[model samples]
Target: MKKILIIGIVASGKTTFAKRLSQKFSLPWYELDSIVHHNTATGRYKRSAEEQFEIIKEIDIKGAWIFEGTDRDSYQCLYQMADTIIFLDTPLWKRKVRILTRFIKQKLGIEKCHYKPDIMMLKMMYKWTRDFEQSRNSFDAKLNRYNEKVIRLRDSNNLDVTKGTRLS
Candidate 1:
């Protein structure tokens, strides 16, 4: 696909999958988290919504790109420009395990995350994973409004980045 949008709850493998897709297709990939969070001498701070919109607009005008994250309201224009959208509908239990594992790794300095890992971040991740089902409905509705091919990968095994064809 020329342009791809990967959306999912935090720690649901969006970044991982997008990276794979980017490598497979030889297209650049952008992690929305990295764009939104700016590291300063003080601490990590988010860019203004207008700034985020401008950044996304620049990416959308590129020849091809794969963007991973969920900020539908802010990146609606990018969503419209995407040729394909892949939704990582991973189960809650798996998401919980991933979130916890990632937190431990980041805390131990074994893994680097876009944002620092802390107790507050961990708690927020847990709550997001627990309430993901409710958020999923809104994602579905948004996807329904777009005509681009949307692939819902419910399990990790279902995604085959090597296969260029869109999943039915």
Candidate 2:
């Protein structure tokens, strides 16, 4: 795929999948969170919706890219721009386990993260996951608009790069 968007909630393996896809396709990958909360000489700050769209546009001009992140209203335009949209629909129980495991790893310094791996952040991760499920209908409806280009994966491990994403 030329332009890809890997979308999912917290701990859904979007980042991992995007990395693999990018490597296989020899494309650049971006974490959308980095765009939303931009780092500067001063500190990290949230960009406005307009600014976020502009950044995405700039990246679009550079050619193929794979962007991974939870769905956000600010960057909804990416859906229309992408050649492929991968939705990681990992199981709820597995995601819950991953959230805890990730927190433990981050807290123990085994895993590096952009933000502090505090209890609050862990709680927020779970909260976001729950919120995502509650609003899945809305998300699915949005996804339907791009049904021709969408691929849903229950687990990233099951994907076979050699066979391509369409293979079961």
Candidate 3:
């Protein structure tokens, strides 16, 4: 209802869905990648974990906003700041399709990372999604402590999120 944080694997639609949520709530949309990639180039500039967290703290200090991304402890730097936390846990194959599509799109010049997203970057994201251990991702820890406020979406098609609640 207030601050919302989105966590998801690569190509899980976090950015797109976050935009929708922003419109639905009439709140400003904050794409972590966008800010993290700002002033750099497409897909090339990535902020360090420390800098990322700093931004989150800055956002929280400024008050209510919708944040969308994974792997930022800065958002968690101010835990209890978010009213709802969304976890987009799509299937590995679905993610791979998305990743490849993004790659193709970027490579085709339809869109750029604002920097660069080479094969290695894609591989890392793919690996993270395919083999990401829930226990390993910081989101898992935040989730465990805030399960009541968490919404888990297991499918890429969003079969589990409904009526403003998590179905499963």
> Which numbered prediction scores highest in lDDT against the true structure?
2
Q: Is candidate 2 or candidate 3 better by lDDT?
A: 2
Query: Per-residue CA lDDT of candidate 2, range 24-76, in tens?
Result: 88999999999999889898899999999999999999999999999999999
Error of 2 at 134 (Å): 1.0
In candidate 3, where is summed lDDT lowest over 10 consecutive residues? Answer: 159-168
Q: Pick the candidate with the highest TM-score.
A: 2
CA displacement after TM-score superposition, residue 117 of candidate 1 (Å): 1.5
Ranking by lDDT: 2, 1, 3
Q: List TM-scores for all candidates, in order.
A: 0.87, 0.93, 0.77
Q: Cα RMSD to native, each candidate?
A: 2.6, 2.4, 3.6
Q: Report the poorest 10 consecutive residues by lDDT, candidate 2.
A: 159-168
Q: TM-score-based ranking, best first?
A: 2, 1, 3
| Per-residue accuracy of model 1 over 74-130 as CA lDDT, tens digit each | 667777778888878777888888988999999999998767699999999888776
**For model 1, what is the alpha-carbon lDDT of residue 112?**
87
- After superposing candidate 2 on the true structure, give the runs of residues whose Cα lies further than 4 Å from its correct spot: 161-168
Higher-TM-score candidate among 1 and 3? 1
